[model samples]
Target chain A: MTGLSFRYGERVALDEVSLSAEAGRFTALLGPNGAGKSTLFSLLTRLLISRQGQIRIAGHDLERQPRAALAALGVVFQDATLDLDLTVAQNLRYFSRLHGLPPRQAEQRAEEELTRLGLWERRNEKVRALNGGHRRRVEIARALLHRPAVLILDEPTVGLDPPTRRLLVDHIHQLCATTGMAVLWATHLIDEVDPISDRVVILHRGRIRAAGDVPVVLAAAHSDSLADAFRHFTPESPPAQEAC
Target chain B: MPWLLALRGIVGREILRFLHQRERFLGALVRPLIWLLVFAAGFRAALGVAIVPPYQTYIPYEVYIVPGLLGMIQLFNGMQSSLSMVYDREMGSMRLLLTSPLPRWWLLVCKLVAGVAVSLLQCWAFLLIATLFGIELPGPGWLTVLPALILNGIMLGALGLVLSSTIRQLENFAGVMNFVVFPLFFCSPALYPLYKMRESSETLYWICEINPFGHGVELIRHALYGQVSWPDLGMVTAVALVLLALAVRGYDPRRGLMKRKGG
Candidate 1:
């Protein structure tokens, strides 16, 4: 998708943002906190529609063919969307059915996706019983059940431990490598970006500060480390209390 | 297929949530049951009953109040669902649902329909229990009550939708109950007829005439006796349409609902 924009009243959330994820490539939508990454996801996924720009998923315009575009994309939201009262299998089955899969096909796919996420054994467990990491895995599995050509994860590892986060990121990298599906993984964590498989886009205060290969983008600021590169783009600002 | 699936998913989630919270279901039953068994029994002698149009012969006060009790449960459930929606919005699950590819209006309608279905189920269950207490309507009247229940469900559910969209947080919901629910219920023909009020005060009669909730209660009242009132239907339909439109507008992203979260 290119040139997608959004605003909340007078304040802009995304300003003429442009990026692309070629098939089989993993693209990390990196930014600092409050850098409009979540807003961009809201725009691309049709949570908040903006008439000022265009978004195409797998060659379909979102506004003209929202269902077709949405069907082609799978998303794991930052928050756990699984119904806590439902079993993992039930949750996945519900999503599968929502995507128009037949009941038999949906059940089989739910099982397969759960197994893929190492959640098959816990399929019957209610989401309330699962830990934070396990619940996130269930969400990822639920997203993949429809087998979309593109996967979008918004801060997928926000609450996980370091090892679990690395494992989740590696799992996503492997999925992209094997399926040739495009991936847009949004996160503030600099270390999550795979130097080989992903391109990086840095957003600052609703604007893209840089976009390109991770090494090249990081190199532009005379910084070898991704963390330093991120700091270079985003500097701490003094807090100003609004006049009463 | 997608629509059916979406409907099922939304409805299933609502039912599962309701089932998990056993207290809510029990409260739905107990609240109306208390009003029927205790409150009604206490007031039956003090409250005089006149022959209303729905009554062919002189019916007891307990039988006359059943439809109103049903309306009360539906209204309370509707508001309860609104509270749940507000809580979901605060908890971020609402964003998950809104992000789905379905049209915003369709998703909202599905949510309202889910609430309606839950309210209807509770209504039916209450009725079955009430039957055991020797409160019975005409055999065909039960069939007639279906349409009334559906209409009342939509009206009340639409009101809940409006509240969910407009209210910023679940914590502020008490003000809504105090300002909206209490007044609508008391001013309406649910507890007493308009003519009964006209005897004592003209203002009360006027308030009942304009109270849309009264039309909903009257719809149930007439339907329970195998009667259909065109005026009540018209008023309920108009109110439902207006409330639903306001709710859809209130939930529109550009205006606030979702955007207000950051603020």
Candidate 2:
């Protein structure tokens, strides 16, 4: 988005927030707590709307053609949204049908996603019976069932163990590589940012502090490590170390 | 085709959830039956029945209240939708439904349809019980009442939708809804006829006359006798459309009650 700005009455949540995510690339939107990462995600998902700037998904403008733009995008919100009363396969099928998938194709894709996520055997189990890690995986699987061109996840690992987080991160990176899908990952943990593969955009106090490849961000901050780079970018409020 | 599929998914999920909550289905059914078998039994000695328009002869008090009991089931179902909607909004599940990439209005309407489907099930169950209880009615009335039942169901369900979107949080829900559910139910011709209220109080009669729930009950009463009230149907249709339009507007991201979150 270019020149995108938003406010909650008096306080500005995001100011002139401009960034881009390219196909086959993972852009990590790194920020401190209350740094507007969620606000930005809400805008991208069209849960919130602003008329200040441009947002395009697969070259379809968001405001002018929201249906086309949103159809091409997949999202996993920060909260657990799966219906606990429904079985794993039921949740997936519900989302698939919402996207207009045929019954036969919806079932096939749901199975493939559940299996790809190593959740095939538990497909009939109620989601309330699953642990946090498994629930996040189910949500991820649901997001990918429609094969969206662009994927976005907001703090998807907030409640999971480190091992599960690492597994999910690796799996998503592999998805970005193999599927040629554009990915925007918003997080506060500095450990999730890799200096070699992923691009980084540091947001501080509702503005982009630094943005580029990991190495470029480090070089711009005159630091060798991402921790120092993050400190340099967000001098007002440091990273949420507890999150790391 | 996709819109239809989404509606099926939404309505199916609601029914599935309703069935899973056996207590809820039983609870929905218990309220109307109590009024039928318990309250109406005592109410019979106190209230005398005259030749009302829908009644050809002086009918029993239980028979007089069958349509009102049906209206109560729908009214409670509509309020149930409101409670669940508020809970869903708090739980983040509502976000999943709203962001379906379909036109937002269509999604909200699908939810409305889902609520109506569940109410229809409970109404049918209640009617079946009434039939078994030896309450006599025209045999063809069963088929005739379907359309009126659906129309009244939508009108009330849409009211629930409007209530959900208008209220921002759950803590303030019950108090606000009581003000709505009780007043609308009691003031309507659900329990007693408007003419009875007219003899007691002039103001009360006009309130009943203006209440859409009364029209809904009247419509159902007429339909159950293989009749229709065009005026009541028109009132209900206009009210349903207006409420639905408001609900659709209320859920919009740029302008609606959801935006009050500012998150």
Candidate 3:
């Protein structure tokens, strides 16, 4: 993304935002509530286009070649996008069809992902019957079904228990390490960012306050901990009347 | 081929949802049946029917209102699907659908086609009930009316799409009923002939004459008798195309309703 900006009418939700994540790396986008993390995800997913800037996913321009750009992306939105009425396998099949995968390939991929996620035993169960952790796993599996070049997750572990959250975080990190997939994980949870995370981009009020390797950001903020670095970059309150 | 597969998936989802919601099917049939069975019986004597343009001979009130009731089924089903669209938007499934790599217009068309398919099923169910009640159309009319039904279904579904794009909340659906469904049903010649409406008020007659729903009913009525009405067909086709274009524009991410966060 290059100078990506977005606004809802007069309220600027993202101001000249720009960031990048390389292959085989896990990048944490840390931000507070209403820090334009979701907005950035929306732009990346092409749900809301940014008029002022450009986004290229896997070398495909989002605006000029949206279909290619979108095809290269795998997204797990903040909200649960699964159909509660459909079985886990059924949900995956439906999404694969949307991605234009053939029946045999779709089924094979669904099985592969479900097995990898260790949810193969529960594939026939309805999504509504699954617990939060399992459901999140199913979503992650669905996102991977198309074998997208980049995986974008917006707060994938928002409401899970601590153990489940840790498990999911580790799973994503493993995916990055093994598949060499560029992963952009957005969250406000500092602990979710592992000490070995390749990079951290801290956004506050629609602007990138600090972005770099964890130790570099820590050094730049003159702090020992990632949480303290986040606090130092993002003040408790904004200066009055400045644009977001 | 990919387009065809996506279409099948989307349409299949709609069908599955329709099947699951038995109450929705029953509600759609029950509303039209009430109008056909009880309401028509009550109003039959009060409102006399002369030789309407679509009807060569004098027809019973129930027979006259059947096409209008068919329009009603499509109208309500169209709105119901749009209601689901709003729900999907709020639930984030719509976001998932929009993010698909397919062209936005094609995706919306898939949604419209799914809605029309459900509406067609409801129309046939209503016709079957009407046939049971001794309001059978000409034998060949069954085959002939397919095109008309499909056209009307698209028209009403497109209108629903337009409304869905503008409506921000699911709670505001009641407002749509009052402003859109009711007016479109009542203002058109769906329940009465234009001449009959003119007997009450000239302004209302003109309103009915111009209503695309009115032309839709006229087109279906003609097709029911294995006949054709070029003017009505043309009007319905034109209206449907225009409304569909508007609906496509309404769903555009940069400019349409999805641009707003809460909306």
Candidate 4:
């Protein structure tokens, strides 16, 4: 995405924001509450159109070729989007059909994804019967069923336990590494960003405060820990040298 | 072909959800049943009817109100479908749907089609109950009314889509009931003939005459007797098309109500 900007009436949600994620890399979008991370995700997913910028997903411009762009993109929103009454496999199959996959292919993909996520045994259980962690896993599995070129997750670990959060973070990172899929993981939790993250984009007040490789962002902020670097870039912090 | 597949998936999901919520099915039936059984029995004596174009002879009050009650089922079901749309938005499922690679118009049309499909089921169920109560249509009337019911279902469902797009929060749905559903149902020829409304008040008679729901009921009522009303069908078709376009525009994220709420 380049020069993307959006406003909700008078309030600017994202202002001239431009960022990119590379395939086979995990890019962390770190921001505090109300910092426009969700807005950016909304734009990337084409849920909200950006009037001021261009977004290209897998070489398909969002505005010019939305179908192709959206076809290549996968998203797991902050809230659980699964039909609670439907079973795990049923939810995945529904998603597969939404992507226009044939019945045989959809069934196979659902099996493969559910098995990969370790939810295969409970595939027949309704989603309402599953725990929160399992539900989130189902959503992640559903998102990956289409084998999208880019995966966008918005604050995916909001209510999970520490162990589950760690597990999910690791699983997505593994997906990035093994499948060569670009990932934009949005979270306010500083711990989710570690030394392994290929790139970090810190957003504050609808603009990019710092964006670069982990080491470069850390060095630019002159902070040893990511937590401190994040604090330094936020609006609440006192004036510091510009990191961008 | 892909669009067809997605349409089938969406429509199938709606049917599954409808089946799961047995209470909704029951409620959709009960509302109109009461109007047909108890209310129509009382109104039968109080209200007298003359030979209308759709009816060659004076019909019983219950007979006149069956088409109206049919419209009521679609009306309530349509609003209920929109209520679910608002709930889906709150629960984030609507976001998943809107982000599909298909054209946005096609997606909304799929939703409309699904809503119409469910409404048709409810309509048939009610008709069966009405049949059990000794109210039967003319031979072949049952088959002929299918197209009219489908058309009316699309019209009402499209109106629901328009409402769902404008209503930002779930809490505001009751407001839709008061402002949209009640007015659209009460003011139309669904409950009474337009000439009867004219006898009471000219303003209301014109209002009912112009109401698309009134035209829908007229179309269904005529078709229920194995007759046709080209003007009523044309009116309903035009209104459905116009409202459907408005619904599509209302959901457009860039310029529609979704943008206003920053969804």
Q: Which digits, one per residue and each the tens of the lDDT, describe model 2 over residues B20-134?
A: 8899999999999999999999989999878897889999999989888889999999988988998888887887787777999999889888998999899989989998998
Candidates 1 and 3 compared by DockQ, better number: 3
Write out the backbone clash pairs for model 3: none
lDDT for A181 (candidate 2): 98
- For candidate 3, the TM-score is 0.96
For each candidate, report its DockQ versus the true two-chain complex.
Answer: 0.41, 0.64, 0.53, 0.59
CA lDDT of each prediction against the hidden true structure: 0.83, 0.88, 0.88, 0.88
Report the poorest 10 consecutive residues by lDDT, candidate 1 chain B.
B254-263
- The fraction of reference A/B contacts recovered in model 4 reads 0.58
- Top-down TM-score ranking: 2, 4, 3, 1
- Displacement of the residue B109 alpha carbon in candidate 4, Å: 0.6
Interface Cα RMSD in Å, per prediction: 2.5, 1.7, 2.1, 1.9
The parts of candidate 3 lying over 4 Å away from their true place are A237-244
Q: Could you estimate the TM-score for every candidate?
A: 0.94, 0.98, 0.96, 0.96
Better of 2 and 3 by TM-score: 2
lDDT of 3 by residue, B100-154 (tens): 9999999989999999999988988989989998985888877898999999999
Q: Which 10 consecutive positions of candidate 2 chain B have the poorest summed lDDT?
A: B254-263
**Candidate 3 chain B least-lDDT 10 residues:** B254-263
Among these predictions, the greatest TM-score belongs to: 2
**Per-prediction fnat values?**
0.34, 0.53, 0.55, 0.58
Cα RMSD for predicted model 1: 3.9
How many backbone clashes can be found in candidate 1? 0
